[model samples]
Target: MRRLLAGLISLFCFTSSTYAAEVSVALAANFSAPMQKIAAAFEQDTGHKAVLSTGATGKFYAQIRHGAPFQLLLAADQTTPERLEREGLAVAGTRFTYAIGQLVLWSTEPGLVDAEGAVLRSERFTRIALADPKLAPYGAAALETLDKLGLRQQLQSKFVQGENIAQTYQFVASGNAPLGFVALSQVFADGRIREGSAWIVPAELHSPLLQDAVILKAGADNPAALALADYLRGEKARSIMQSYGYGF
Candidate 1:
């Protein structure tokens, strides 16, 4: 009886492992932190793994166009996914908004940035970091904010551009630049700033950041990919996103 029970347990373990799936995902740089947690939870709950690669959405779009093998895309803006649908690179009707992101002007040093963000006019810092506007939605929003404040041209000379929002945050965190515009999720958690000082850029200052996710054509028949899409829309995933300061 003991030998028979051991055989049955081993067979069940093998069967479960055989059915577990892994889906490759392309994630926006800004959503990396929360997505990591979501991916873990997804595997635990569904017995499927999510393999994540994070980067600028625009770059991912170009890569997808050029035949990158990603099965899913979580973009920083809605337009990219919409475009993919138009271009027939993504599966039709699989797109949906997962989060609305906020932007912030942040510095590693405390008290350098005022509540009203008046530090932009003071010329106190020699350099400021931002992502490439052409490649990153957060970078474009940063430019829009400066333009709204009528400081774009004046601040352009002090600009240090990063490849993506993650790099932008790293610039401020490492003191390569005293401060920079970054995704609020990078510096915020649990309804407050996690570290350093930040002035949350108001939504009215720039266009709304409607982030969306979609399954790619390559994943149209992939069960794991489809499952992950459904998972992102579930309450558990939204709670994780909320903790990271993302809006539904």
Candidate 2:
């Protein structure tokens, strides 16, 4: 009887361990910092691991369409996730807004970008970086802002495009471009600037960047993936996102 009972207990442990699965997430580059904190909290609270892949939302969309193994997608915009759902790549009714991103014109050099963003009119810099509008929503917002200011044509020769917001920020931070448009969350934390200079772009300059999250069809039945999605909507994850300058 003792031997039989011990074998049954071992089987139960094995089954329980198998159920504690790891979820793979494709995350937008701009949300990388805050997502790290959220992923860690998710693992601790749920006993499930979250593995992250970060890059431009466009690239992620392409990869998912081609059958990438990611179980979830945290997109930089709402459109991509909706497309995935419509195409049957994502689980239906699982999409929700996760964050609203803010765009900013930033420079690693202090005081280079004025609060009013008059520096663009000054045309003092040789090169300005922005993400490729075709690939990054923040880049689209930057382009819209430039167009609204009537500077797109004037500054056409000075534009440098990065494939994603992370690379766009790198171009300015590394001095390859004197100024660049980036996600505000990248340079701001805890209600203060973390470095250099920045001008928060007026919201009216572009459409609202509503970020969304969805469960891919591959993870529709995965407990870990479901848990991570729920955790993202919880107080802890929301607080971390707020600290990183993201709005719901």
Candidate 3:
């Protein structure tokens, strides 16, 4: 009886492992930190693994268009996912807003940026890092904020563009640029700034950054991909997103 029971248990374990699915996900650069935690929880709870690829949203969109074989997409802006849905690249009626991101002007040095963001007018710094406007929504928002402050043309010569928001954060954090526009989540932790100084850019300065997610057509028959999409909308994932300073 003991030997028979051991054989049954081993067969069950082997079957479960063999059937577990792995979903490929294309993620936005700004969502990296929180997605890591969420993906881990997903695997633990559902036994489905998520493989992530992070980069600028625009670049991801281009890759998806060129047959990138990704099963899911988490974009930095709503427009990209909406376009994919309209273009039939994504599954119909599966797109939804996952988070709203806040922009911040940050510097590695303490006291470099004030609450009012007066440092922009002072011209005390030589280089200001921003993501490439054409490829990153955060970079476009940075430009809009500068234009609102009437400093776009004046700061143009000093601007340094990065490939994505992650790279933009690295530029400032590494002191390559004294200051840069980045997602607040990148520098925030446990309800406060992680390090350095930051000026929280008011939402009125730019259009709302409503991030959206969608399951791709390639994942239409993938149960794991569908499960991941549903999991992202559940309370556990929502709590994790909130911890990262993302808004609903």
Candidate 4:
């Protein structure tokens, strides 16, 4: 019994030291809810902590440019990561799209806006919230959908901007705004839309939301950073993401 106990102790110490590092991440707000799940699983499986910071993709770019100490970046769009790589801030050949996101016009109030977006034409609401188009990808999609339907100028006065997609969700969830555009992942449960009334914006309304992730140049030598990126592409992570309304 004593020998068995000693061996077990020896094994535990070896495993602990083997997976002791932490990986710092900059995650886009649209991905916050799912990333939380991924983070928990990642720590359990690898014993590497994931310290996450969530923000608008644009703002995160600014942070990286100014030396924010993030090891991995999961952006709502590919441009920022590509740009970072181009600017030599991220390691070359380490960039890839992690998930494809969808845009939705959502409201806590049922039937406020038809999923087809026909409600926007009626001008029934005094406020419509969205993230800043210059920041969040979902906001960009929202603006494009409105523009495609020629409601940009008509609804200009009612626009409320959030710093990121997460805040945009809060605007509607807290009734700060009656309706808003957000990532479909917000309302998705078990790979489907589970609650609230929403219009899954037609793809024709905007460009595809190809979210990307990459290892920053500052973390080029860190295996933990690469491992996190690899885990995102793994089956377990992909399953969790699918359950959250993201694709491939």
Over 3-121, each residue of candidate 2 has an lDDT whose tens digit, in order, gives: 99999999998987987789999999999999999998888888899999999999999999998999999999999999999999999999999889999999989999999999999
Deviating ranges (above 4 Å) for candidate 2: 1-16
**How would you order the candidates by lDDT, starting with the best?**
1, 3, 2, 4
> Which residue segments of model 1 deviate by more than 4 Å?
none
User: What is the Cα-based lDDT of residue 225 in candidate 4?
Assistant: 93
True-structure Cα RMSD, model 4 = 1.8
TM-score of 4: 0.94
Q: lDDT for every model?
A: 0.95, 0.94, 0.94, 0.91
lDDT of 4 at 125: 89
Q: In model 3, how many backbone clashes occur? A: 0
Candidate 4 stretches with Cα past 4 Å from truth are 1-11
Candidate 4: tens digits of C-alpha lDDT, residues 29-131: 9999999999999989987888999999999999999998898999999999999999999999999999999998889887787867888888688999999
- What is the lDDT, from 0 to 100, of the residue 147 in candidate 1? 97
Cα deviation of 107 in candidate 4 (Å)?
Answer: 0.2
- Estimate the Cα RMSD of every predicted model relative to the unseen true structure: 1.3, 2.3, 1.3, 1.8
Superposed by TM-score, candidate 2 places the C-alpha of residue 147 at a distance from the truth, in angstroms, of 0.9
Lowest lDDT 10-residue stretch of candidate 3? 12-21
| Model 3 lDDT per residue over 183-214, tens place | 99899889988988999999999999999999
